[model samples]
Structures are given as structure tokens and as C-alpha cells.
Target: MNDRLNLFQAARFGSPFGSPFGSPFGSPFGSPFDLAHQAGEYWLDAWQRSVLFMDAMRQRGDDHEEKLTQAAPHVLNFEFDVVMDGRDLARPVNYSLLRIHTPEGVVVDANRRPFIVFDPRAGHGPGIGGMKHDSEIGVVLRAGHPCYFVGFLPQPVHGQTIEDVCQAEARFIAKVAELHPDADGKPALIGNCQAGWQIMMTSALNPDLTGPLVLAGTPLSYWAGVRGKNPLRYLGGLLGGTWLTAFTGDLGCGIFDGANLVSNFESMNPANTWWKKEYKVYSEIDTEAERYLEFEKWWGNPVLLNAQEMQYIADNLFVGNRLSSGSIHDSAGRRIDLRNVKSPVVVFCSWGDDVTPPQQALGWVLDMYQDDDAMALSGQTIIYALHETIGHLGIFVSATVANKEHEEFTGAMDLIDVLPPGLYEAVFVEKTKDTVNAGLVDGNYVVRFERRFLDDVRALGGNDQEDERRFAAVARLSDVNLGLYRTFASPLVKAAINEQGAEWLRQLHPYRLRYKLFSSKSPLLFGIAGAAERVRAQRAPAKPDNVFTMLQEAWSRQVVGVLDQYRDLRDSAVERYFMNVYGSPVLQALVGLRADDGRVRQLGRDIARETVAASARAKLVEQAGVGGTPEAIIRALLYVLRAPELRAADERGYAMLRELRTHSEEGKVMSLAHFKDVVQQQAQILSWNEEAGFVALPLLLPPSSAEREHALDVVRQVAGAAGELEGEAAERMARIAAMFSAAVKLAG
Candidate 1:
């Protein structure tokens, strides 16, 4: 545990490694003379930190090598004793199936349900999902769910393929299901980043294997990104194609280093990568060492992917964006479609995540379904939640996020299943409890589903038809480049490189070399670790009031600012070159991609429209404005409670209305979907002419006096569901409630 010293505590901004404290609040230095007197101490402190910084760097590198060395081949970063290894699976892949061992005193109910989590295999090693106490696995286990993990080995099996991995995953889910016979549903699958798409593929091919699927910071539409931003998406087109991936793999003797992927990610944010990340650790080494080292343990452990696997992923998924287009096929030649997924999908994304922005995370909905009605008629529930600002890794491991978002989401999975089959935004609203609605809430917040449409996904800054054309062109170019490379370049590259040489080259990568050279094994950094130890005994962190401390922070900020500008400039140049090259109509036509990008989206719209038309004749007719008297009143009430912008959708209120509806002999068997439809119709009606809605209330109200009083009581309960409804909402709710009450008493 790192010490929590408030040396530089001011504005708190969290980094991936740790939420570092800001510069000191007020000046402690009384005068220039006073500051000058302590200058010698400041200089000493600076020198000490510099030495410690180098020593820590050496330790980080040494730690990286030591961890790899000590782990005699089977390195499960997770705290799990492998019960069912991938080697024992039906079609064994590089991945292993392990049951996460619950910590002592964390009594998990074995029969409740199993929660299987897959960490992203992008570049880093597995176990990040379980890296902290407050995490996806941790919350689920505490909530009494049996937990399982799908992790991969450092090295791939000789003939392993993605298809084999997906098949193996299905077998893993089957085993989990076999273990928990009493679970209400199948294992709830949680996939972070890269694992997200894999889970979707597994669930799509084997529909019976999964329950609800949670995809956190995962991009299904690989080409989906905002313009002038998310430059990582531009690399394929800028570099001509994924031919580089093949060339890289060939140089590595048919293996792709995960470190290379990690380096690419680091390059995206130079401010963090070049300066701020290390500076933070160096400045607060005494208090940040534990966290820095913990994160590094996983960060340093880069796994390997087979050359074929890399080629397939880069060609089919990344550059081609084939998943969204449904062009990718399984081993059985059946198309792997997102629409084929039987389980509900819960997509959680953050606006702050540049890697997998909200556009990339949720844009597939628009690519798959043409309109909201088509989505609603599919009988598949897709729920999405967007955060204001949390970075990619924060989605998986941030303590505050894990407790709030993951906690609420996991708690509501049962409710998610029972929800009407449609597109919904799973909204979490903070509980004010100012009103008498305490009985309605179980905790400090309430989770509700707001109806969403395909347009809502399109609004996230992706979905440009023209930009997708360029990506399609890149896919075509990639095939050509990869073919040429394999024919002309691969043999020579492979001949020159063996396993030993490839390993040596990978270790020589800049990211790895930085750590390797900083270690104590290097004579230049000799005795530094020992000197740091001696300095630690009389260590003194600079006072924030100190002028020198302020100057140091200012210098760091300036350096980071310059790096950020450079990153922006580099990204601009990259995007410009990619657009200019790939956006050429002649070039696109030559590559046979001129018509593809346009056709994919058009086909999606056509399928959705056709599905709606064909299914509508066979489907049940909607029951909006058709339910009996009680439903009319409840629907009217739903309209009023929608506040100004129609924000709050109280599940408890909906429950209360259903309970009340039972009092009268009307709408007893009405499904929630029918109720929702009625609510939407009524809201629309009220929006047209608010006074007309009030005047028309008498028709919906019961003629009998006793029933009129009963309806008013239900209205009161629904209105008060959120507790202490305030402002305009409370006033509107009261006015509407009174109108219905009056209409009921005076009904003809």
C-alpha cells in the first residue's frame, strides 16, 4: 500500500496508473528571501528525486524481466488456480478457462449464476479485470455470482486460430453452465476491449452459450471513429494496409509481439507517454510506487499472437471492418452476425475514451439495424450506457467507476432480462431522496431504461458514408499488399530471422529497451538502487508553497503541452495523407472497393426495412391507446412524470402503476411493452396540445366515484416514486393528477 501523503493535493485528475494529486493550493513561501534560504533544501530534494527516479526506472525494468523469468511458462496474472485449462478444452486454443478463486470471507453463491470475464488481448497480458478489489469480477462475486475467467498464454499453440478460440470459449461456457445447474440464465459474459468482439462472435455462433453480454470499451465497427480525432484508425490507410502487420510478423518469425500494439497505444497520447506518466511516479515515488508497480506488472507482460491470427484479425476485422458488414464467416461457412446474437447486449462506453469512443462502441447498432422500429421488432434487447468522462482502462479497473457503474449494472442484469425487447439507454440517475420516495429506492441511485433509436447511435460522431469508403479501399489495398509481401518479401524475412533472433529483436524494441537499460544490470545505473535506499531514510518531499516545487511542476506542464501539440500535428498529417491517398475514386475503383462501402450500409437498411415488413404481417399489432380505463390513466400519468426533457423513467413508478392497475378489471394481462407504447402515445398527445390532453381525461377516467378515488391514489404513488419530486416536474405532476381526479369525479 502506498502512503497517502497530501503533499501536492489540489485539483485531482486521475491517470491510468493512479489519480495523481495536483500542485499545492496556496503559497507557503513568505517572501523571496525565505524561498532563497530554502533553495539549498529544494536543490537537495530535486537531486534526491532524480536519483530515486532513475533507481525506480531500473526497478521497473528489472521487475519486468524478473516477472517474466520467474513465471516458469504458465503465468496466470489472475488469482486463480486453473481448474480447466485450455489444453483440456475440446478444440484447444491459446486461451485457458479458469474459475476465479474468491478471496477469504467473500462468500459467493455457487448457484446464483456464473460471471465469466475476458480481458482484452490487444497488447497487454490478461488479469486486468481482476487487478483491483473494486472491479467487474470483484463486484459480481460480492453480489453472489460464481465467477470465471478466460485468459490466454504468453505464446500461442502452433496451429491455433480465432475459430478454435471461439469454439474453445463455447466449451468453457458450457462447462460453467454444467457447474451451475440452478443458475436462472446462462453465464453472463463480460468482455473488455478485444475480448468484446470475440464474445460477440462466440455468442452469435453458439446462441445457447451466453446470457446477457457486457461489452466495455469494445469497438465492433473497426472503421467507426470521429474525424480529426481517433487517428489510430487512420494507420491502416496511411500505411497502405495491414501488409505492415504481415511484414512485422514475418520479421518476428511468424509471431506478433503484443508490445508493438501497446507501443502504438502509447504513441496516441504523447503527453502521458513521454512525460506526465513517469514524472508523476518520480515526483511521488514514496506514495505511488505500489500502484505504479502493480499496473506495470500487467503492462510489462506482453503476450504473443500467431502470425496467421494477426493476419486474419488485421485483414478481416480491423482494416476490412467485416464484422459490422457481416462478411466474416465461421468455420461452418455460416455468416457471423451481431443480429444472430440471442443474448441481450449491454454496451458501456465513455466519451473520454479516444481509443474506443462512444461512436466505435455503440455505432454497430446503426450499421446492423436501419431504424428503431426494426430494432424493437427483433425480440433482442440491446442496452447501452454512456459515461461523461472516463478513459478506457478506467472502465475496467477504476474503483469509483467499478462501485457505481458496474455495481448498478450487475445488480440490474435480472431486470435487464425482463425488459421489453427493444433498444434502450440504461440510465442511472442519482437519488435525491428529498421527497417521500425512499421506499421506492434500494440504494443511493435508481436504474431506468429510456427508449433509444438508431439515430441516437449515429449522433456519436461516426457513420460517415464517404469516410467508410476510404476504409473499404484500405481493405482492398491490404489484400494486394499482403499478397505481394508474402510472394516477394516474407521468405527472405523469415529466412533471416529464427526464434532466437526474433526474440532478441522484440526485446530491442524502444519500449522494452528503455526498461532493459535502466536496470541495475547496466553498469551505468550501478549502485543507484542502493543510493536510492540510503536517500529514502532522510527523504523530504518538497512543500507545494516552495517556489522551486512550483517551478518544477510548471516545467513539467510545459513539456507535456509541447508533446500534446506534436501529437496533434502528427495525427493531422497522418489523417490528411490517409484521406488524400485512400479517398481517390480512381484508386478505389482500381481496388474494387468503390461500390463496397456504399453497399454495406445500404444493405443493412434494406434488410431492416424488409425484416420489419415481413415480420409485421406475422407480428402482434401494437396496443397503444387501446388498453382499458386504468391503463389510459397510468399512461396519462407517465406523460406528466416525464419532466421537462423526458429524463426520468422510474422503474418503481412503473411497478406501482401495475400494482394499482390490478385494483380495476382492466389491463390485467397487459405486457410492459404495451404499457410503454401507451405511455409514448400519451406523451406525444400531450406534447401536441397540453390542454387538450387534460380535457380528454374524463373519457379515460372511470364513471364510478369509488374507482375515481382509486385512480387518484395510484397517481399519487407514481408521482411520489422518485421521492421529493421538485421544480417544474412536481408542479406538472400535481396539475395533471388533479385534472384526472376532477375528470374522474365528473365523468359522464
Candidate 2:
């Protein structure tokens, strides 16, 4: 019995490779009994330590709960007026106008066209877009655009279809347009997250209602991602397709809880959700936790969607990828064609966003257009901007991002308007103290945009025919399963559920249970009131060397790390398992799925034809005479391309230009009219470059070089001015100057 006990002790603490109890002296020659005793002592100490640690955690949890309850009133008191009754809260000020007030006292000028900001109805409530002065509404308002928020009611209107909500949004836009008959531009629409795609559908159906659109962190290309990167895309397959979504909705008796959506988002980053978010709050509980709790109050409070709506989203948008494929249609048989949108689309996405990655955000650009030529042929202008590292919500909600990215975009709205009907990428660059070309007239930051081929966008997200094939199979299976549910189970479920029962079920939901239990009514929580007050009073604040606190922090971090690794492992296993199961020939046969189908084949062909046509059209426009010949247009484009560089080197080029005096004497006069003509000609030749030259020439050229050396000197000084030439405009100006210098030398 003693030997057996010693053996058990040895196994508990020692490495598995060697037995310490056998020899009775550690190893072959050593006293294994001594080692076993030592091991036993270590384990006993560890067990005691673990017990104490757990007790500490229990006490900490109690304290945390107390602190939370104490702070709840201040943290959860959201100040916005929901009824539009014109009542001002101590926090959120209410307004009747279709405009949001900025902290800077800048009233956004509303256009007759009507601006609508559709906030994502995820787990959170309204005001993310206008939470700070540097937010989406703030940027729009600063630009003098009238803004209206498409906020939801605390409780959803009964029998609300997504279609009904869309119709209501359209009506709101129409009313705004009616109000502003004389506004300069049409109402610009901005949608964040889910709202982004909703607006797209709205615009598709009512094509004429919207003008420009900004879709921030919205995933249109749901199936897009690189390997190991977008694990969320693989989730539906692992969970036996979207049947779970349908099942949940059915169980809710026609209303699906939005908490599931929020929970899914949290699950993607266990580290952030489980530990980092709370730890950051605990570490700075005095101040930072207030904002954290405020956000959580909304995040934890989820809205409900009709089962039909949830099922529709799951089947069509998430799993099917039907929106981008043009496979989705309304009841009226009108295909939801994104290409029908006449206005420009600005897509803003980021690398750090796991929810709506750059691939999902921008991949649809590729999905919609075959090439840049097709984009121009369709008279569509798509501009996309990529951030290095901002999360999904941060793309629209973060104030710093809003001030920089959103502000720059809003400031350059007009530039985007006149950007010619083509695909382009907008890049925001910080200007140094030394950049000398002509276009940049602002601060340290300048937005530099370049015309990009659709192929470039496609390259960002690689083609995965295999994945698409798998998704198609999932779609087919979903349709089959949905049919089975409707034919078999749905009828019984619907007959059994009543309005009261549904409401009861929703109240009893796990997500809502905590909120209901904790709010003022529970008798069990009465003691919590006084306990919270005392805990707040006796709060032992953080210090650098508190060992217990340090251990707590370290343990918290370890827990988070373990959770993260577990999530990653789970994601990988699920993805692999699904790919193996769903990608099988047997499953494909069962579902009557084909890897390559007529729809995909037709889509490919359509893409090819569109690309060819667009290329030809762009080529025609590029070769079109500024006035007469193809060569002249080509020359004009070259001239415009080099204008900015030449302008910058004008001083250096002026020496050569001084040699052109003989030519100027010989009726080769450098007049403002000729310069203007050259710019206009260049603009017309390149089609898109036409505006660049037109805008550039007025700013680039002085009245004349009539005084030769004096004019040249003034031109050089103006050209050398710090803020004068910047961005693409500066580059174009320099190129023009270079071309002129070459032309002059040849003539000489």
C-alpha cells in the first residue's frame, strides 16, 4: 500500500518517461521513495495553492458583480430620444430635423436628395454612426449634407418583413428628396455592416432613389477569403448548414433572437471577448470601464427578427452568396442587379476585420465587373479604400478612423463624383513638408487616388472555384431542407405557437434572462444594492507589485490564450471536417450538385463578354480624337500623364524652355488659351484624364511666359511653393511640362 501510494505520487508530478517509485531512490541507483515523497509534497502544495486561487477568484467575482451593479445605473443610462418627441436628454440631445448636430456646432447642410445612414441592427442599438464628433454622421454633417438615421424601435413592429423595412427606408428617402428640391447633389447613402447590403438591395429595386453610396465593412462576397484566414465562412457547413438558423427561428415561434448573431461575433475572437475586453475594463475600472459597460449595455441588448427574415438572410445572403451572383430576385421577378446602380460606390474595409474582411468587402467588385473596361461600359464608378488594421465595427464606429478615413472621403466627395465612370482605388497618404507638385492644398494628409483595373481588385481575393462549388452544394441542400421543414414540421410548429407564447419564450431566452433577473425587481438582488455600495467604497485599486493581483492578471491572460487557441483549433478542425465531408463526391451526388453548372458557366461567359466590351470601349475612348485623330488623343494622354513631373522640374526644364525663344519668336507663342486647349485636349483623350487636365491647367499655368526669364522665374517660384503641387494633379502637371519641353526641343 505504501509502495502503491508512492507510485501514484511519482506519476502525479514526475515526467511520464521514468518511474520514481520502482527503485525507491529516484532512478535506478537513487532513492525513488525520496523523489516520490518530494513529488507528493509538491502536488499537495499545488492543490492547496489551487484551492486558494479558486477562492480568490470566487471573491473577485463577487466583488466584480457588486461593482458592476453599483455602476450599472450610470453606465447603462443611454440618453437618446426614441419617440422623436423633441425631449432632450442629459446625454443625447434630441433634434427634429433630418440632421445630426456636431460638437463643433457645424450644422450639416441637407440636400433635397436626402442622406440616410442605416446603422447595423446587430446586437447594438443606434448612435454608433453619430456617437462621437468624428463619426459618420459627424463627417456627413460637417460636409453640409442632411443626414437621417434609420433607427429601429426597441420592440420590432409585429409582422415586419425585411421587405417592409426596406420599403419604409425608401419612403423616408423620398420624403427627404421632396423636402430638398433645390439641393446641388442627390442624397448620399451610407450603410454600416448589415445595413450596407440592405441599402444595396433598396437601391437595386428603386435604382433611381439613391445617388452615391458608402458601404463600410459590409460583406457582399460572403464566400471570399484566403486559407486559414476567414474561418467564419466555414461555420455554416460545420454546423450542418443553415438548418440550425432555421431551427432556432422556428423554435422562437417566428421571432429569432439577435443575441445569437452577437454571440457568433464574440465566438470569433475568444481572446478579445472573454478576457482582453474585461481585463482592459478591470485594469482601468475607474474610467475606461464606463465606456466598456456602456457599449456592452447595447451589445448585450439584442433585437429580434422574424424567423422568415433570419432564414432569408441565412439561405440567400450568408450561405448562397446570391446577391453578388444576381441569383436573388424580388417577388415581382426583378433581379437584384447591383450593376443597375447609377451612382458611385465607395467600399471601405480593413485587414483586421474578421467579420467582413477586405476579401468579403471588396471581392464583390470583382464579382460584379469583369474588368475595368466593363466597369466603364456600365457607367459605374467603384472606389475602394483599405485600412491596414481596423476591426469590423471600427471601420465605421471608431472616431479616429472616422476623422481620418471618413473625413477625407467626405471632403473628397466631389472629386469622387467627377472621377469618370470606372473602377479606382483611393489611397490616403500623409504629405511631408517637402512635396512640391500642384494638387495638394490641404494639411499634412492628402488623399491620392489611382484608377485601378478590376483585375487588381480580383487579385486581392483569389478565385476559389472549389469553395464556390461547395457553397453551391450547401445552397442546394438548404433549399431541400427548408422544403422538408415547411412540408413536415413548420405547420405543426406554427399551429402550436401564439403571440403570448412567443413573447413568453423570448423573455425566457438565455440572453434576456440575466437582464430580466438583475433589473430592479428581483428580491434576491436586494442585498446586492448595499453590497455594491460597500464594495465601491472599499475598492482596493491596482498597484504595480501586488502579487495576488499580478497572479490574477496572469491567470486571466492564460485563460484568454487557452480560449483563443481552442477557438483556432476548433475553427481549423471544423473547416477541415466540412471540406472533407461536403467536398465528397457522395454528398455532391446526394444533393444533385455539380461542381460546374450552366449558371457558373454563363456567369463566366458574361464576365468575359463584359470585359471585352469594356476594354474595347475604354480603348475607343482613349483613342478618340481630342478634336480629330487617334494619335492626337494618345499623345494628349501621354502629355497629361507627364504634366505634373514636368511642372515640378519646370525650373530645370525652363533652361531648355529658354532655348525655345527662337520657336516662340517664330509664331510658337505660349498663350493661356493654348495651355487651356492642351489641357482640354488631354482630358478628352484619356476620357477620365480630361477633368484632371482641366482642373490642373488653370492652377498650373500663369497668365503668360510673355516676359520670358521673369515669367519663368515666377513660374518656378510658384511651382516650388510647398503646397502648390501635390497628389495625382501635381504628377500630371509635371508630366505636361516635360512633354512641352521635349516638344520645344524637337521644334528647335
Candidate with the greatest lDDT versus the true structure: 1
What are the per-residue Cα lDDT tens digits for candidate 1 across 216-293?
Answer: 999888888888878888888877888899989988888899898999888899899888888998788777776887
User: Which predicted model would earn the best TM-score?
Assistant: 1
Cα lDDT of model 2 by residue, 1-748, tens digit: 5543443443343344465533423453235554455445445434433333333333333432443344121111113322232122222211122344333556655543346677777655545676656678767666667666656544455565666566666665676667677765566788899989988888888877876888999999887887788988887777666777877777777778887888789889988876787566555555564466445545555666777778788888888888888787787787777887767799999989999988888877777766564566566778888888899878987888988888777766644544446666777667665555424434345665566776677677744776666767777787787778778887787778787887788777675565455544555444554554554565544333333344455667678879888988988887788678877877877898755554341233346546765675566453443232222322333343334332121222222233322223234643322332333334334555554433343222222333322333333343443345557656655655554444344434
- Cα lDDT computed for each candidate against the true fold: 0.75, 0.61
Candidate 1 lDDT (Cα, whole model)?
Answer: 0.75
Of candidate 1, the 10-residue stretch with the lowest lDDT total is 1-10
Kindly provide the TM-score of model 1 when superposed on the true structure, using C-alpha atoms. Answer: 0.82
